[model samples]
Target: MTENPLKAKDEQPFVIDPIADTGAAKWSYFSLTFSLFYFFHIIAKYEQYTNTQLISVFVIYICFIALFFQAIRSTGKAVLKPIIAIVILSAVGAAINPGTNALFGYAAFFSGYYFLRKYAVLLLILNLAAQISSALILDLLSPYYLGPSLACSFSLFVYGIFSQKEYIHSCLQQKKNQQIEQLAAIAERERIARDMHDLLGHSLSSLALKSELAEKLANKQHFEAAKKEISEVASLARQTLSEVRLAVTGLKLQGLSGSLQKLTNELKNMKFDTQCYIDALNLPPMVESTLIILSKEWITNILRHSNGNSVSIAITTDANNVTLSIGDNGKTAKIKPGNGIEGMRSRVAELSGSLDINDDDGVKLTVVIPLLATVRSNVKNKAIVSV
Candidate 1:
């Protein structure tokens, strides 16, 4: 089966670790020259081994050096062959030269922490034994700095553990912040809009009715009630309409990001997993507001009609155009055009954008506006969902 690109984003680690991104120093990583430092140390005791033994050890050491940085940086299954080769080479290098284990153990320590964490303890133990056994075999155990050597590897191990924790914390923190901001933007406007609309309509209707009745009462010379009603009507009529109108239309949570974030939470409540890929770049007020309204309407329609559980909302911009797509796995073969859909079309048409609806096994609502050239700049098409 073909994997969905959207689901791949979910499986990625959210944290950007400083160490893993750039391994060692540039010169050290590329040249494979760091291993030679240990080679010279073993060579200082030159008479013990013949030139043939030295050359063979050199050949083995070079191969081990080649994978030094990669072992630390690449713990993926793709690097499995190199990792196995390096582990064998590390043991062989230790037999020829005890100091070689200390120099190369950095690779195993870091790889254990980041990629192969489940076996980190075992790798560390084996690495320590490699260092110690070399010293004992060469009768150089007393002279060897084995204690500090092991401690140095352990320090890297400790840092790796914390780095993993930091990555997890970063992921959780991002998710928490996304939910809070989305809820704050979504719920605040919804609560006030819904409550005030119901309350104001009832109040205005009652006030208008009483004022007209008061007008009749004044003709019958019931002056006191008439005076009170006329005064109240005069005060309330202009005030209610002006305030309610503003509250209903003016105070929408601005920007495409916040608005879409809120809509995502709404879909989540309806058992729909919504992924929104809104860019960090700001759009023009008109463009942003249009998308904000359009996306909300799309989600609202899907929740009302669909049985599917997944939706992906994405916005992409290039040098000449801006495209917004909302897709769902719903039954769209018999979609009835309503005011909401009409309004969505009208809104896009006003901006000289085309609104398209695809109704195959699913529905995909796409709006492309070529009129917003200034708003569309160089932006990547990759989906950065929430975090």
Candidate 2:
């Protein structure tokens, strides 16, 4: 079974360490600066302590600072051990001298950050209990120490929660961006495959037919006719090569009318009586490119499959839509959708268009695409440019 992404995210170890990162390290230094006040407080009253007592407090305070830094630098469960040590040192330091009570705030913050909510809360309660017990047992209970210590602990704990949330959000956003890039790459590859098929399919079929016609004429001793057919084949091959080059360079078809006329000539070559009609319409490059490619795909299908001798091609535009229809008086049969047909559908769908195929009389394809606002804008821009 596929694991839920949110659940997996919770299980993954954090990849960043606060103390090891430049920006986070600066903030760590800023927070650690506040802990110096307690260290200095002990120093200010050093005259009241014997040598043994003073040395013990100093050692405990140093160990607490070292462990605190280590805990922040560590990742995963490795951080827990040092954090637990810091909590113990905080309690021991408080018992030795109430001035070091502020150390418990640092412990509370680490526990909240490095653990889940329930575990962090339990650790927090333990820290509070340890502080209160030490103060009450040593007759050191005072509002001046207890009130500020509690406030600091809660404030830092909340800050830690917010920081953890921010980090998680950042990681998720990065993952989403990567997925979007992968999807775009796949779409681009499919587009190239579709374009190559439309460009080469018709040209290859025409070449094959012309080659056979030339060979038959040569066998009948009609040298001039055979030579003419071979010349046409060479010309068609060069044109196909140029189109492939332009397609690879991401350039759209330059002249829609010329392309349509060329298709009509190819139909006549196959002895098909073709009728063509095109309206005077201004279309955007992308729309024109899609129309030309779809036309090629349909004509190629007719040449390979149709048995009739007549074909009709029409392109017209009204106030609200552009329509393209291609039909042939061919033998009608069950139309099984193939890659070429599916590619045409995909192209039309991208323009928010509809395609219908009917085999009642003969095979006919009709496509209607709405006149989008962007298309109207392009037409207006072209009119201004012409003026």
Q: lDDT (0-100) at residue 65 of candidate 1?
A: 62
RMSD to native for every prediction?
A: 16.7, 18.4
173-204 per-residue lDDT for model 2 (tens digits): 54554566568557766787788898799899
TM-scores, all candidates, are: 0.44, 0.56
TM-score quality measure for candidate 2: 0.56
Q: Which whole-number lDDT from 0 to 100 does residue 49 have in model 2?
A: 76
Compose the digit string of candidate 1's lDDT tens values, residues 43-92: 68888988887897778776776676555444334344454566556656
lDDT (C-alpha, whole model) for all candidates: 0.65, 0.75
